[model samples]
Every structure is written in C-alpha cells, then in structure tokens.
Target: MKREILTLAFARAVSVEFIATLIFVFIGLGSALKWPSALPSILQISLAFGLAIGTMVQAFGHISGAHINPAVTIAFFVGNQISFLRTLFYVVAQLVGAIAGAGILYGVTPANTRGNLAINALNNNTSPGQALVVEMILTFQLAICIFASTDNRRSGGVGSPALSIGLSVALGHLIGIYFTGCSMNPARSFGPAVVMRRFSPAHWV
Candidate 1:
C-alpha cells in the first residue's frame, strides 16, 4: 500500500503551494515597490497583500488548503492537524515559490524602480526585541484567524474564510509595516531578501 504522501493529491497540493506562494509574493512585494510613477502607500500595500492572499485562498484553498505562509503550515503541524512530512514539503515548496516570485518581479521591474525589492527590514528606532514581539503578536493573530476560518468542526457559522484570512493579513500589515515591513509570514520576508542578497542584522525578525 502506498502512503498518502506519494499520491497524486499530495503532489497536486505541493505544486499548488509553490505556485500560490510565488504569485502571492510577486503581488504583495510588487505592491510595495517604489515605482517610477508613484510610491505605494501603506494602505495600498496592505490591501494588495490582503487581496493577493484572499485571491490565492479562494483559488487554491481546496487543493492545498492554501497554507501560503510557513507560519500557518507550521502552526497546523504543531497542532497535529497536518503530518510533519506534509508540513516540511509545503514549507519547502512555498519558500522556493517565494524566491522565484521575487526573482521574476525583479526581472520585470525597472532597475531604478527596484528599490531593495521591498525587502523586510527593521526600523531604525526598532530593536530586534521590539520587532520580534511585533512579529509574534501580528503573526499569532493571523494564525488564529486562519485556524478559525479553516476549521471543519464548526457548524456552518464561519463565513468567508478567504475574506477573513485576507483581512487579517491586511490588519497585520497596517501596523507591522511600520516596524518590520509586516512579515506575518516569514516566507514573505525571506523571498525578497534571498533574491536581493540583502539581509539586515534583524532579518530573522
């Protein structure tokens, strides 16, 4: 008997994770990028990130559960909702997707307009400790929102998982952008940094 990991369904999920994360990063970072026309506002970036997430969730949630964020994948694994092997594969796929997305955006964007690939960085006034706390709190909320929206045991009370998850991501960015460029999802932070090869001291945050 073959394990579920080797099945077609598992392969499809992994592929979707890669594609979804790639598109998500491309759109999310593309929004924050400083264009020759005009710089993206915080609200613009927030909505872009949120919309990207919502679109992806609605598009792929059925196949891969749309755990676009590694934090969400790990959270599911930690809660015993997913197998460790599945979590590992999904995280790997997402990370690779993110890097590819950032790379593609970099290639398409003008050199002068490509400002640091909109990489996440700590604010001058913000210490690593402060950034860590902010990341934790914001990510925790996003994770909780994802969990609640995706839970199957609920008796039909949950409404619009995609919208709920997307809005939660936007809410995180509304404040997180000021501190750490709002990386509730580490893959979101990691993609541009790897592509740009520009890692700040507090890049982990």
Candidate 2:
C-alpha cells in the first residue's frame, strides 16, 4: 500500500473504528453495570460482548476493516498487513474512538451505575507478570483470529468476519475476565480509564 498522511481510506477506517468502538463500549459497559443482576453468568456477559462485536463488525466492516481493537491493529502492522503511516493513523483513530465511546457511555449511564467505567486490572492475588502473560496469550489468539478471518486466502467465508471476530473477543473474555477483566483491546481499557480519570501505568501495559 502507498504511504499517505491522510487519505479517504484512512478517514473511513478511522470513522468506522470510532463508531464501532463506541457501540462496543456502550453495549459492553452497559451490560457490565445495568444488567449485572441478570448477567451474573460469565457466559452471558461473554455473549453480550461477542454479540456486540459481531454486530458492529457486520455494520462497519466494509467501511474500515472493522478493527475496533488497537492490539489487533498493532499486530497487523507487525504482521506487515498495513503500512507504517496507516498504522499511526489507525492507532490514533482507535484511541480517539475509544475515548469517544467511553465518553458517550458515561453520559448515557446513570451515575450510580458508572462503577469506574469497568476499568480492567488484575484480581486480588494475580501478579503483574502473570497479568501480562495472560494478556499476551489472549491477545495473541485474538490477533491471530483477526489475521485468519480477514485473510481472503485463508478464510472459507463460511461465517461472516463479524461473527468470527466477535467469537474471538468472547473467547478472550471467557478466560481473561477472571484474570484482568480480559482487556484484549488496549483502546477498550484506555478509553474507560481516561473517562474515569483512573489512567494508570498498568493500563498502558
């Protein structure tokens, strides 16, 4: 791909990223708080997240490749699927999209239900190293799935890319939720952190 500062493709990609992320956060966070009672089952929460991602990707995939996660974007860049300049633009767009998503979630939700906007972190006894390892493992699988599902050469096209992507997200949440609330997407964590004013070094990790 040719390197350009800002092109129509980049803009569309960024806009799609922002809107998709906003929907992801709004639905995911909304479920975490509003439906906490009914959504006590981890499976329920996982499905909620998964379904949100699936829906967003279906809605926005054609517009921006449906990259709602920064980690996936980084890995794709590392995998040489995207150009450097494009990577920079995508990352910035993802971050801004994340913040916008979080902001909208904060505004729409009730004050009592905010709960720090569901910031992700280690549980009571998990170590920092363990958390990192877990995040890496989960994110690796996630990024790999993104690469595979989006790869025209590899995919059979039996399932929608949106469905596959959402399934991957839910898979991570199933295992990582107990570890670090399963923040496979840094933008997902960062957006809420910035909004709740609880941005921490750990979040950067």
Candidate 3:
C-alpha cells in the first residue's frame, strides 16, 4: 500500500505540473499572437499571463505546488523547497507541456498569425548588457515573491500565493515586455524556440 501510494503521488505530481505548464503556455502565448487590430491591449496581455498563473496555482497547488515555470522550479530547488528528483521531473514535464501548448496554439491560429510562438527576444533597441540587466531584475523579483509566498514557515499563511506569483509575472512583463517579452521562465522560452526553430542569440546559454 505504501509503495502504491508513492507511485500514485509521483504520477499525480507530474500530471499537475504538465497541465499547469500547458495552461501557462497556452494563455501567455495566445495573448501575444497577432490578432485583429482590435484585440486585447498590452495590459490585457500582462493580465492574461498573470491571471492564468493565479488560477492554475489554486487549481494544482496541492499535488504539484503548481510551479508551471522552470525558473520558479529551479529557484525552489536551489532553496530546498523541492527534492532534486522532483525538480528534474518537473522541468521535463514543463518542457514537454510547453511544446505541446505551442503546437496547439500553432494549429489554432492562422499561419501568418502564429507569431513565432511568442518566443522572447531582445528588441533591436536594447543593448546586450541592458537585456541581461532586464532579465536579471525581472527574474529577481519573481524569485523573491516565490520564496516569500511559498515559505509557509515564514509567512505563516497571510495572502494568496497564487495572487502573489501572478502579480510578479505581470510586473516582470510590464517592464521586460519591451526588452525581452519577459521570459522569466526558461521553459517558456525553450518550447517556443524548439517549435519555431528560431532560436535567438539570447536563447543560447
């Protein structure tokens, strides 16, 4: 019975991670795709990424902690919030889900409107140094929020973790959007690049 429960837990965890990643990629990238000129505004796009994250956390928090972002997972792993094995599996699941999400978006949208799967890239105006600074700042804030909200021992359960995380994601996008479209998460960047085969210079390690 113990072995069975362990197996079940592992399955549930990966499934939760996969589904959350899928939702995150779908909503975030969907908003960035080319649409009718009258489509949603930039704020709306930011909010979509934020809200998708907020709700997904609530929906999958128990089974997987609903990371849905590789950067968040890596940070948590570094902080000892999750096991190394779990982190490895989480990253794999996230990448797979992200690719699946991008593929789905491609199939649903018009060929011309696919928008390169919303891959993040440094705009022409930004210097490489500026781009690096931008990503560091954006991800620093995001990591700080994740550490705070999910640190149950520290926060003692104050506000909603989902809300906090989503807000961080939106905040990063607000600033990083102009520079890098706010990757904040490597898996978010990876899947689209793999799908579109348009890896940018910044995408290289």
Candidate 4:
C-alpha cells in the first residue's frame, strides 16, 4: 500500500510537471511569433515568458513544485530536494511537454510565420564564448532567485514567489535576449529545435 501510494504521487507529480511545461512553452513561444503586421517587442516577449512561468508555478507549485524547467529540476536534485528518480522523471516530463507545446504552436501557426518556434540563437556577431557566459550568468541568477523565493524557512518581505520569479525571468530576458535570445532553460531551447528540425551546433551550448 505504501508503494502504491508513492507510485501514485510520483505519477501525479510527473503529470503536473508535463502540463505546466507545456503551458509555459506554448504561451511563451507563441508570443514571439511574427504576425502579419506586428512584431513582438523585446518587452513583450520577455513578459510572455516571465508571465507564463509565474502563472504555471502558481497553478501547479503545490502539486509538483511547478518545476517546468529542466535546469530547475536539476538544481533541486543537486540541493537534495528531490530524489534522483524523481528528478529524472521531472526532466523527462518537462522535455516532453516542451516538445508538445512547440509542436502545437507549429501546427496552429502559418508556415511562414513559424520562425523555428523561437529557437534561441546568438544575435549580431556575439561569439559562442560570449553567449555561453551570458547564458550561464542569467541561469545562475534565476537559480538563486528560485532557491530564495521557494525557501519555506525564509521570511517574506514582498510579493508572492510567483511574482518574484516572474520578474526575475523578465529581467533576465530583457538583458539576455539581445545576446542569446535568452534561453536559461535547456528544455525551452530544445523543444523548438526538435520540432522545427533546425538544430545548430550553437544550440547544444
């Protein structure tokens, strides 16, 4: 009976993660799609991702801790917040969810407007090394924010955890977008690349 209960809990957690990640990728990338008359501004795109993540967290945090990103799941594992098997399940769910979300976006939008489902790439002449540094820094900041906001022992002084995390994501995108299209989550980058079949060596970085 105990084993059955644990299995059910694990299944529920995986399902929640998958659903949250699907929502995150779908809404976030959909906001960046090039419409006929208007292109999304950096602010708009940033908010899309930020808000999506924040909303997903709020919606599913109780169920699965809303770990929609593979990086976040790995961080939780490294911090001993989750077991290795659970971490693996969460990461797999997130990746699958991301791909499903991107795939749905691809199916709905016109072919011409579906620009690789907003795959992350270095803008301008930014070198691979520079892009890597920027991504690392942005992800590190995000990870720290996650740890702080979600720490139940920490005293709260401001808004909800969702809002704080959302704002951080937006801020990161505002800065990192110009350099590397702001991909702090590997799953976010992987989904579109897989759906569009547009893998570049830089994407692996």
Highest-lDDT candidate: 1
Better of 1 and 2 by TM-score: 1
TM value for model 1 = 0.97
Best to worst by lDDT, what's the order? 1, 4, 3, 2
lDDT of 2 by residue, 1-205 (tens): 5545447777778777877887887777666764444535678778888999889889888877787887777787888877877777777887887888889889987786778778887887988888999999988888878777778876355566788888988999999989888888888888888888896656755
TM-score of each: 0.97, 0.90, 0.92, 0.95
Cα-based lDDT for every prediction: 0.94, 0.80, 0.84, 0.90
Best by TM-score: 1
Q: How much is the lDDT of residue 122 in candidate 4?
A: 86
- Give all candidate RMSDs, comma-separated: 1.2, 2.2, 2.4, 1.9
Clashes of each: 0, 0, 0, 0
Off by over 4 Å in 1: none
Global fold similarity of model 4 (TM-score): 0.95
RMSD of 4: 1.9
Report the C-alpha lDDT of model 1 over 1-205, residue by residue, as the tens digit.
Answer: 2397889999999999999999999999999989878989999999999999999999999999999999999999999988989999999999999999999999999999999999998888999999999999999999999999888899968999999999999999999999988899878989999999998888877
lDDT, candidate 3, 23-102, per-residue tens: 88988899888775656567877998899888999899988889898888888889877777788889999999999888
